[model samples]
Target: MVGQWSGREARALREAKRMSIREFAAHLGVHERLVSKWEAGGDRVHPRPVNQAALDTCLARSDDIERTRFAALAAPEPDSGPRPDAGRSAAPGGYSNDAELLALIDTGAARGEGLAAISEKDLIMAAAHEASEHAGRAEGTNIGPSTLDQLDADITRIANDYVHTPPMPMMVEMLRVRRRVYRLLEGHQRPSDTSHLYLLAGSLSGLLANASTDLGYLDAAGEQIRASWAYAEISGHNGLRAWARGMHALIEYWSERPHRALQLAQNGLQYADSATAAVRLHNIEARIWSKIGSTADTERAIHAAADASSAAAADSLHDEVGGVFGFSDAKASYYAGATYIHLGLAEPALAATERTIELYRTGPARQRSYGAESLARVDSAAAHLINGSLDGAEAALLPVLALDEDKRIAQLEERLTGVRRRICAPAFRGVAEARALDERIEEFCGSTATRSLPPGSG
Candidate 1:
């Protein structure tokens, strides 16, 4: 009979059952990595008592043929003598068995259980106590509290940086953190840890989705937002759910599906749990309604966003993690400006854009999103051009024309192109000032981020 079972015997049981490491771990309700640890530890490592009991139950379920094979594989070599502790009395409790013995011997030395005069029973007791501690640690989570804290902090920093940082570098950092979260998810973790990790994954995916959209990769952005939505669902985070829906709506809005975008924004409202989320959804709806030329609906959405903003409350995703996930007054004003431009309300568009630019300039330095600010200038320029004020339009477009090439995003170029089109229209076709402004805008659009991307990359 096999007097005791260690990692070697555990490996034999796995082989006897003709099971792969994953299958064996699944059968025993343990992590695959834990199974690998057991097999790799060989004769030196013993599982905790609960895992030992699980092992016993697993072996008992084996058929006679599997048991025979297990016995043969588990038997010690013929030349091998008795184990050093063979003469000791059988361990009490469930450990008194034919095939396996388990204790905290691996961690017991630090507790003075390794001293020469210690009785076997005392050693077993110490080992059993240690095993209980180990089981608690293992079953609770694989990740440490500090690791989760660092990940949460990283997400917050990334969110804040997204507003000002270039998209390509942010995407790289996002992918790296996403990979870490994905790896943590692959191993065993507590339910709470799993939920926390999924939230992080969803946020990172949402950022990637925005970056993809900015780079003109609508299909890839769609995939990323869908993944974000899935992770949000798994984590049961209402804030992430609302945010993901808004991102999906944004992608569809840029894809020229205004109706679908409107529907998505409205649907996202159901998941909005905070003022910021509600305001974000309303603003998105406003933009889409304006895109579809529904002035009354657009006005209603803008009003709704204002009302929501008045009821601001702390939200983990938006307020607590205030970066790209946030909806600031400046951004909201920018959206209103853009909607006014779409509805051809030159006076209100100019007013809204002026407010938008003022808010960005006077707000927290970290909250200033250069791309949004530039887009506001473009909208202001468009309003001036509509009002037949070439001088006003030129003044509005000064900063936009001076932006670095890498800072020139797709939306910025698209807005500038709109201004160029207006300048090229019949009313301004022969105006020398409009003609010069049009040429400058054309040059500005030529060296944009999307244009500079490697061939077919976007």
Candidate 2:
């Protein structure tokens, strides 16, 4: 049952496996560049014979039409329709890999002269230095005061837009801006200006770290936080330092390293006086305490957060960025409700959740974070289930279930998991509504809407 083969065919197989190029390459014991070449060549290119066998065996289990077609292509003596000379047309690799080019030069110069008499090597070295100088001059154009202001404004806009947008897409934009800011750092600038740039980088990394977390890449998020902390340290900005530490603590918390989370919170609190980071660090401490089931510690931390909130209001200093930095009544209530849920305080959790929803709906339109609100709804539903109000629980979660597939994030899914567990409790086992709820949730979970990401999601 051999069928046609093409680049489109190869691409479909790779995507069906849900692998990055590097992952696919690793799976096939091939280089990433080679895979790219294969895809670029379309019908003319195919995996080497042995590799074709591996692709067939590995992908045969998939029921998808695309993968099924891919299986056919992998079969012996497949028909490759009108082959295009894509490999010849493709440009050579760029000079981005300095080490590889240098290695080539080294191998070429390994003559009896012992590397001193290689004219070609000298020419390449000179050319590389000239190219670097040219790039440096081009980057220098970005070092003016006005350019710095533009960068600052751009970062602020991206940060402000973060709460309303999906993290997977914003992460790419953050990385792009971060790369541009890094380029600017290589140019000539005053020490103060350089420090300002570092602060901006720290803020961007903070946003990226949060985005990584939202997309369920906690390990990647942790590395981004480490980079953010370094940038904050170099800038010597107390607010940035505090924010970075709080973010670091949150990563540790999510990773289930509670002791490290508490330690990071304490470190952040040292810089917390008269800053909005004060409110954030205090709230983080309360969250850690709740995780450990320490009622007294949680209460003390919650009280400190309230005091910090009031002091922060008087100080007039605020986060230059948005997304993860700002602290508000709605945000505080949401955190408290989540903490209460961790502490098994059903009544207080419900109350805080109610306040969260009310404030989000009635407060400033700019302050509305739909992702946070969705989680709050899940919390409210879980609280209802705790009280044995099955119908109330189901009703509270209807809006969450109704969300557009793209709008459902990892946090919302995790929150819904708690509801699912509650629905299966002995009290609700015989309930028809409980079964219906489970079925509806299962259907939603199995949908392609949850699986099909938009372009550039990586």
Candidate 3:
């Protein structure tokens, strides 16, 4: 079953029906833009709940031939018809399957083979042999290599999609995938396979932690991050450990616990083996230091981040499975801008924000994060406000103000709140332009992404 269709499945279904994007959208009663977005999202993006239902209905109404085409397109793999020993009958001296093997044991019991007649050591050896036979029948793993590969791919997709996709849809996908991982973990597997599963679980947990933080559920985020940390430890994955620690530090920072956040970030530095992870930790530390009003410490951390970024290295978590786990130059600049804002360094903040915006624009199309870009815009506006250029501030915030409400994350709202406060300062008091901008910001904050999240999402 093509259950809970993602963009990949949806596109496959469309192709199977031999319909273009416009035709598919018309059939599904949605705008063509949404279909394009889904197709662009590939396997990572999920349509809205209503659209998901529409897709489900469309698939349900498909004929067998169409379903066959979808199954082929959605999952193209070499056929290995069946297991080698399929339908083989038992030989006179041996069994063909587990059931036949069990029957052989029962026959022995029927021939007056009693436990009392067998020596204790011999019986123990027999039991061990039987268990070994069962364990060695095929493979101990409930999942095959292909399944693991698919899981790995899905994890990478989710990680890459987290920044661009809406939080609710991304969270839904995360929860579904996490449950699949949990079910796999509940079954028996080789130690190596178990470790891989744990690593995936940790990554998903860390992502969920970040989502929870974005939704203003600090307590939930804290619990989720702890689970991520535990999974990372079990998996013995240093990269995941570092990323989880960074996420925890971010949650603490937003919770207004600068000391705890700093401690977390400092501890994570030890596990940050890759340049990206190290840079992320250093940037986090710089932010915490800024929050603590320690300009020297903040500057030192910022320089450390720059040093770390220079020594670029591939990391399993940050580089290979990048999305929210990544710390790009643009994101680093955004972090620096945010830190500068807290330090009241308007000039540096403006410079950092400009670099951030430029990098985001000029970087790979897939890597451009709207949320990060919008936040940078807010930071730029804040710097302008600090410089007493109301016109510049207003200009800087135009893009942010134009953002879709669904993309207006809590952090963006919080930043805008700060900007509004700045606008309400004595210098801007009684100014009609400032009052108008303030009102607009207030309205924007009123309907944020977090606020619109469905019930029980956390």
Q: By TM-score, who's the top model here?
A: 1
Ranking by lDDT: 1, 3, 2
Model 2, global lDDT: 0.73
Residues 1-458, model 2: lDDT tens digits: 22544444555577666555566788778777766666645566677766676566556656677576655554444356533222221223211223223333434533455344334544476468648855664454447658777878778777767777766567778999899889988665667888988988988898888887777678988999899889988988777778789988988998889899999999988776554778778888998999989999999999988877666332212354655567777888998988998888889999999999999999767668877887888899888888999888888788878877766766676677778898999999989999999888766665322255666644
Alpha-carbon RMSD, candidate 1: 10.9
Model 1 residue 275 distance off true place after TM-score fit, in angstroms: 0.8
What does candidate 1's lDDT look like per residue over 168-252, in tens digits?
Answer: 8888899999999999998778888999999999999999998888777889999999999999999999999999999999999
- For model 3, state the Cα shift of residue 370 in Å: 1.1
* Ranking of all predicted structures according to TM-score, beginning with the best and ending with the worst: 1, 3, 2
Q: Worst ten-residue run, lDDT, model 1?
A: 92-101
- The residue-level lDDT of candidate 3 at 32 comes to 76
Give residue 186's lDDT in candidate 1 (0 to 100). Answer: 80
Better lDDT candidate (2, 3): 3
Clashing pairs in 1: 159-323
Model 3, 1-458: lDDT tens digits are 65677877887899898765666899999987777667645566799889988998999999999999998988843467753333433333233333233334545631344433334443355467657755673355788869889988988899888887777789889999999999999776788999999999999999899888777788999999999999999999999999999999999999999899989999999999999999999999999999899999998998998899888676888998888888888898999899999999999999999999999888887888888899999999999999999999999999998887777888888899999989999999999999999999998898888777678744
Determine the C-alpha RMSD for candidate 2 after optimal superposition of all C-alphas: 16.2
